[model samples]
Target: MKPIELMRAEAVNLTEDPDEVCGYWRGHLVWVKQEDADGLWYVRVNHPDGGYLYDGFWRAHRDCTAADAVAEAFRGAELLEDE
Candidate 1:
């Protein structure tokens, strides 16, 4: 998607699972999961262009909300565009 299109795109959830959630935001894939041990959220963002921000791995958001995690992924996507 074009940068402008991406910037305007809203996140779309792909699953209804309670423990895990997957969505797409501005052409980036975002996955958020709650850890069974600590109940913290794990967020991962994957861009189609493949950037250093995510590298196809999950990052602990540590007490962050699902919306915050999604926002974080969108921020990562924006940063990747700056590169």
Candidate 2:
């Protein structure tokens, strides 16, 4: 599927459940999980081999929608394509 299609699909899934993330960023496998902090969300990026990448978070949940949080996580995702 195209990137836009992926984005829309991911966004829909996120909207359904902010903590559900069976999605991808670029070609990287990703998942959205909840953090211990209130309103804190985590986008878990990982290696194709199932290794750890980094945590992605945004504290602006104060005035944001579920889609907003997913978008924020997308912003923090690393694009792995080469130049």
Candidate 3:
């Protein structure tokens, strides 16, 4: 799959955490949040219908910004987005 630019909803946070961010990328709803135990970042991409599109833990360190985490998720889940 080819890479595409990501567009984020700056004021959106699908989860309860206000610090986390959520937006749609390539028709999938992408959300980035930090892990409580490991302090790593993880992302969840849901389809337009709210079905699970992709869910994975990014290799980002605790200091990684939300934008970077979301970008990693988008890049890692490119192939899954096609289905």
lDDT (0-100) at residue 18 of candidate 3? 32
Which segments of candidate 1 are over 4 A away from where they belong?
1-9, 16-18, 55-64, 75-83
Model 2 lDDT per residue over 29-58, tens place: 656655644666666666667776656665
lDDT per residue, candidate 3, 5-72, as tens digits?
33533324344343366666556677778875455777787767888756877666656666666667
Candidate 3's error at 30, in angstroms?
A: 0.4
Q: How do the predictions measure up, each by TM-score? A: 0.49, 0.50, 0.58
Cα lDDT tens digits, model 1, 1-83, are: 53223433555656535556576665666676666545465656676575434533335445654555555555654545455
The 0-to-1 C-alpha lDDT of every candidate, in the order given, reads 0.54, 0.53, 0.60
- Candidate 3: lDDT of 72? 72
Q: Which has the greatest lDDT?
A: 3
Clashes of each: 0, 0, 0
Runs of candidate 2 exceeding 4 Å displacement: 1-5, 9-16, 34-37, 80-83
Full ranking by TM-score: 3, 2, 1
